[model samples]
Target: MSAQRKLSSIGGGQKTHQFVDDSNRFEELMRLGHSDVQIRVVKYGEESSGRRPLVILNSIDFPMPPSEQFCDRMWRARFRVVFIERPGFGTSTPLPGVLLQSETIRNGAASMAEAAILQEVFRRLALEDFVLLGMGSANSVCYRLAMICPMVALAIFSNAVFNQNILDVFRPNWFQAMLRQTIQSRAGLQIASFGVKYRLRRNPEGFYGQVLQKSAGDLGYLQNNLADFERGAELFQGIEAQTIEYDLNMSLKPDSLLKDGLFETTNAVAFSGLETTDHWKSQLNQEAKRLSIDVEYAPNGDLYAPYASPEFLLKVITDRLNRLGAAQSG
Candidate 1:
């Protein structure tokens, strides 16, 4: 069952979203086995021109479709962007018994389930070769996909969490640390997730303001691109609290993804902003070295590079694709 509608400006409670350019974007629900996965497909250029496909697994903090402006740039650069609203996020159904079990959440079974669903989704889309782009926590899913799905020709990650242990290096404040420990339990996680959802609904601006304070680059981008930031935040509010709880619990696991050697066979590159915290930079450097993959630092970029430094992101993609082409020809 699939349906399509023209993209248009929408108004939230107190905020008006006007930055999502009026473009030919449509949402479709893909029936995979017993569940339906919602996907937002935005095409930019001519299909007959052989535009490449870019599969975006959005970060947990920003689990929304890309802005029309961002999609337009990808289209102009000959790439079709597909945004997957993962299970329990948008209208998509959560995998059976995956999120309900604490054992699954703590053991990373949820991520493996997501990766399997994504692999099936790619096969149905007939995407034999596509670029996989992941941001933040979604990068774990990307690593898993690249290892299992041969269709992933190139994997690009931005501001990715290297492992669960890296969070320890952040040395969070006492209150933050307490909250993190509290969330280890199911009841505490539910309460925290609900609190976050409430904050996002009632005072998104303040919520995001506090969240981005650690990265000046992201904070400046949020201040400068309020409309764009708010647009994403509006979509962010729609995500289910259960989904947030599952992601948070999974991130706390010591053996999640990279820590278990899942990234060993992935063809990937990681990017971080130059102005990111020393803790993040140090972890990313160590992980990149351990994985033997390349890490590029974007000038004046940060956690919000997708929204703030689109040009730099595009340049990196274009250069990599060109190099791949040259290598194939040679």
Candidate 2:
């Protein structure tokens, strides 16, 4: 919530977005949870517009002040987007020692409770049809949110990691004192920035270049993404203690949500990276099929496939939204 990118009109009724940096919602929510935390939100599109908004709950790693590419896409599609930085990360307060008590992954869904707050924000603006989308790291929280808050219209996921028995991938001991030390350290921030910049420069195509290839008919779409990563130091500024913990606590459980009937959601669309682990998706496909919902793998992609397959991602989302929308209409 430190800074924001306001809307840039691309002509016609299509409009870019304006973000209210330093949203107070986080502060308010912190009081309610008794969890000393900070949260920042990047509001997109014209909030006043009577459009069905898209609330993108980003992965724990990447925070708000969204990529212009995402904004441009949302703008053109006539959808409003808001990316919020979870507590103890980004501009929010540091993670309290008590955070040391949760399932590590349970902290992942702490924001599920935040849904009530976000709902109030949306309502004040009258953006009634708000659909939720979650990226790789976000799928966990999104799952719980969709489960706990059944009022949500649809849950669209990108590279959902739950199909993997997260417990198999991570463990409590993984939250070693060393990792926590790094997250709270100055060196960790610099390291994260340099690391991302290095990756983007090395594979702009894989990082974000692959996303727009099918739609633009040219490789030029990557230029902006490349630039963002090129200035990775700035694009990835601010550290979130929660994000740091989320990464280290790899084995934390994210599927207990099923017992609560959250996954009973009849409307869900998932697009996963074919190159990534197929298990969580394998599980999702089975579950979706059993529930009569659709789960499809990207024609050809990886964990970052959502970026690589934005068009396909949109189609999946639009399809799910259509079904969910039709249900509401009926």
Candidate 3:
């Protein structure tokens, strides 16, 4: 059967269709809220499995839909994996006035706006109880979701900086430091976004090479996995420049979801790459302690742990799910 026809047989009308050339996954553009913003949702695994949902928020740097390989792995593990493209990324419509006011972006309004959209997504998908998985900067949104979405049974972050100030405390490379400064003003962010788009369009391989150079571990993995690297570069290049600016603006700010008692009702864990700087590891450790969650280090892992250490990530996730199951049964 044709992919579209096959997907149509599964239900949900035109809103859901097979992802381009990928039979194992389907994408849906859901119209959400009064503003009629369209949120693109990608689904993996069989809905009939009745497994608890695994909702993933991918890193802003590569804010693309989950890969076919990743989706197959999750499906084999019996997870109904759903990847939601954050507002402004992928085909999802940007939140209204996302770039208009720096104050709104800084004062937690952006996070709240995203959280509200996510809440509606969960409702629409009937994801009453699910595990939340976040990668890198996207973990900031995960925090806001965990705070407001009572249905989040567990939250996991991979290579995330919970506190933006940690960059200052640890002092990243000059390039990384300068990248953070782009968010201080709308103009700076737009300019930086334009530069990124230009570089990706002009010479994608070089752009990705330069990007991965900072993390030897990730670079090595992608070097051996050329297909994955090319796919990622294509996705990264597909992101809109304005969306890039908005995503960075929200991610670079000090996380406002760290309010008192936010995680009291939520269970959370973190995974960090051993290849990351000691300062980053230190910050992850401290934040894990404050949140009263466990942290696991993936040997030879780096900032791109999601891409480079998928097996390790899966193992950690499976272990946690087993423990949660055990606790609930007990």
Each prediction's RMSD over C-alphas, in Å, is 6.2, 8.8, 3.5
Better of 1 and 3 by lDDT: 3
Evaluated at residue 34, the lDDT of candidate 3 is 48
Q: What is the lDDT of candidate 1?
A: 0.66
TM-score of each: 0.81, 0.62, 0.84
Cα error, residue 16 of model 1, in Å, equals 25
Q: Which predicted model would earn the best lDDT?
A: 3
Question: What digit string (tens of lDDT, one per residue) describes model 3 on residues 145-202?
Answer: 8767889888887776765355553223544654665766656766766676667667
Candidate number of the best TM-score:
3
Ranking by lDDT: 3, 1, 2
Q: What is the lDDT for 68 in model 2?
A: 60
lDDT of 1 at 61: 68
**1 or 2: which has the higher lDDT?**
1
Best first by TM-score, ranked:
3, 1, 2
lDDT of 3: 0.68
